[model samples]
Target: MSLYFFARSLVYVIFKPLYRIKITGLEHFPKEGAVLLCSNHIDNFDPPVVGITSPRKVHFMAKAEAFKLPILGKLLPDLGAFPVRRGMSDREALRVGLKILKEGNVLGLFPEGTRSRNGELGQGLSGAGFFALRSDALIVPCAIIGPYKAFRSLKVVYGKPVNIDELRARKASADETTELIMKEIQNLLEKNR
Candidate 1:
């Protein structure tokens, strides 16, 4: 936890000025307890940017490759981040995310699974939706409007939380739930764009 806060503080101080990030809807974040941030991926910097901009500690899921570097691997987990295999069914990543939620901490997910090459929305892979359904955590839908647009200050808007009861009634399985959640998240992103 110390390392997480320390790293978070560093990022908050260092890159925030460089990015000139603008964030709204911070009040939607719960003051305490479990929460999930479901965001659209636009660049490799998204996770760290979101983590730093957030007011609370956020456990972000990163590709396994990033963890291969010994120093980064050791530092990342301590800094409230974890690794998930990119192209495989990584049960471990899912378990880690669930554990974070169970512990009443925030879990950050890029529903699209990776950075967008064309700066457009990618298919949300369902991880965020499945996690939300299983953990009964608040899903905070967020969108980054100008991530790929060069040299421009990026705007990240956090939408209102999705009601879990309403989401569960529409789906019988994790995949279905994921699809619905993605659609909801995508709609917000498109509208804001």
Candidate 2:
């Protein structure tokens, strides 16, 4: 945990200034315990953008390809990121996510599954919905706006917690829950615009 703080702090110190990032709703982050941070995908920098701006160190999911480079493959794990194969079931990725929640750490996820090359908000996959339902972790719906714009002040608006119990009680189907979560993320992003 100390190492996670060290690495994240070091990067935050360097990047926050370099990027001139601006963020809001950081007060919404729980001061202690685990949280699932679900955010929109915009650029390749989205993960680090949220990681650095976040009040807590975020253990974000990174695509397997980022770790294909030998040195990074070894280093990313230490930085609290694990890889997920793009097209596979990725049980390992899911396990890590659940374990992180179980261990009481912030698990950041881009609900869109991948970066949006066109800078448009994309549909969120079921990964976030499933993880939230399984772990009962507090899901913080987040929006990252303007990070894709170079030299612009990036805004991140975090919405109130998503209640999984309501979903279960409502007996929402898999697709329904995913679409609901995506819509919440989309609405937050739209508000930031």
Worst 10 residues of 1 by lDDT: 144-153
Best by lDDT: 2
Give stretches of model 1 more than 4 Å off: 148-151, 169-171
Per-residue error (Å), model 2, residue 122 = 0.6
Candidate 1's residue-wise lDDT over 89-124, tens digit each? 899999999999999999988888877888877777
**What TM-score does candidate 1 reach?**
0.89
Per-residue lDDT for 1-193 in model 2, tens only? 5666777778778766666677878777887787989988887777777877777878988888889898888888887898888877899999989999998889998888888887788888888877877776788888988754545577778888776788877766766777777888888877888
TM-score of every prediction relative to native: 0.89, 0.90
RMSD of each: 2.0, 1.9
